[model samples]
Target: MKDCEFFFESKENVEQDGRVILDEYRTHLKDKNTREDINDNELLEKCINIVFEHMKYNRVYIYGIGSSSVVAREFKLRFMRLGLDVDYLAESHSIRMNITRVNQESLVIGISVSGKTEEVIEGLREAKEKGAKTIMLSAARVYEYRSYYDELILIGGLKNLAISDKISPQVPALIVVDILYSHYLNYNNDNKKEKLQMTLEHINYELEE
Candidate 1:
């Protein structure tokens, strides 16, 4: 039998290597302009208006799979805390099954960075057929699926660099989410701030227990 030997780098060397990796990551991110492209004030304002209109009288259903699903869940939680009737389905099967609940009085948001997820496209298509307002967040302008969604919010970044795989795929979508959330906080006077406060307090209380 032969004995196995293991070697570990010193803390100083490990930290130096980690710093180099982080520096490269930051450089790549800086070179990426996806967020800048989405920072169009006019477009974002229009989207805010559309979402607020639908939210006033309808329920919200967000759908996404894989990394996009993470964005959907975060959006749901943030809006829910603001006292909005919002929910999310991250799995293809769940989205298909619960999609029946969507109707004219519903707002469906599909997050697909690549703009080619079949499940996301199908979900938006069905929602449109049911007379629900549909919105899509994607990096690519998928002209083929134009009829499926009422609004298309284009995500910005390196379209050719496959940045999502190297970093977080949901970064661009999350930027839009935060923008919408801020708009809602400023525009709505439905005691949403109070609701947010209460939700935060509840979470803290739970944590302290």
Candidate 2:
């Protein structure tokens, strides 16, 4: 009868808070969207050229936490499928030891919703110190270490929440990472566009069924 009761009854079928948040996130995509969308798209365009210029060496490192880390993994997989050398650093020990040094030509892509995440920031810091080209995907403004990074891609504007946050913020962050994937496709002359386009056409055709 009630929402809580329905949730309890369907506990096995229904997912918990994480799923709820993700579902709400998907739904929020249908909504009009917020200011973050514009900035994020801009960042995507700016990074595409740089990514293309260094297509060689092929090594890429991604850093982030929580959902942001999952997003980074998806980006890494997309790059890998496109034949680039991609690596993931989501843990404390691996991040510290594995990424100790990076090739000068390598690209280190860092994604952080808060931009204030200590681990990702520190990892990026290390990568930079070791001579890797650093690129940041963050919603927060550039901080004191601005000179250390090669590029900072800002996604989403600020939106404060009291008790619970609206989905308006989360979806745009996801979309920004997706935009990076799209940008890679466009930059590398990859068939992801035609492939995705064809897939969408098929989906639409099937929906008609």
Measured against the true structure, the TM-scores of the candidates, in listed sequence, are 0.81, 0.68
Q: Tens digits of per-residue lDDT for model 2 on 1-209? A: 69989878888665675687686655544434334443456566767766665566657888866667676777776666555577878776766775745767778888777777677788888778778888887767766768657888766544541112755433456667667766778775756566555655755743334
Best by lDDT: 1
* Stretch of 10 with least lDDT, candidate 1: 1-10
How does candidate 2 fare on TM-score? 0.68
Write candidate 1's Cα lDDT for 1-209 as tens digits: 12322224356677887897576556544654554556767767777777778777878999999989999999999889888888899998988997779999889999988887889899999999999988888878787898998878876654442345445768767877888789878875678788888998988844345
Could you give the C-alpha RMSD of every candidate to the true structure, in order shown? 4.0, 6.6
lDDT of 2 at 73: 78
Question: Ten residues in a row with the worst lDDT in model 2?
Answer: 161-170
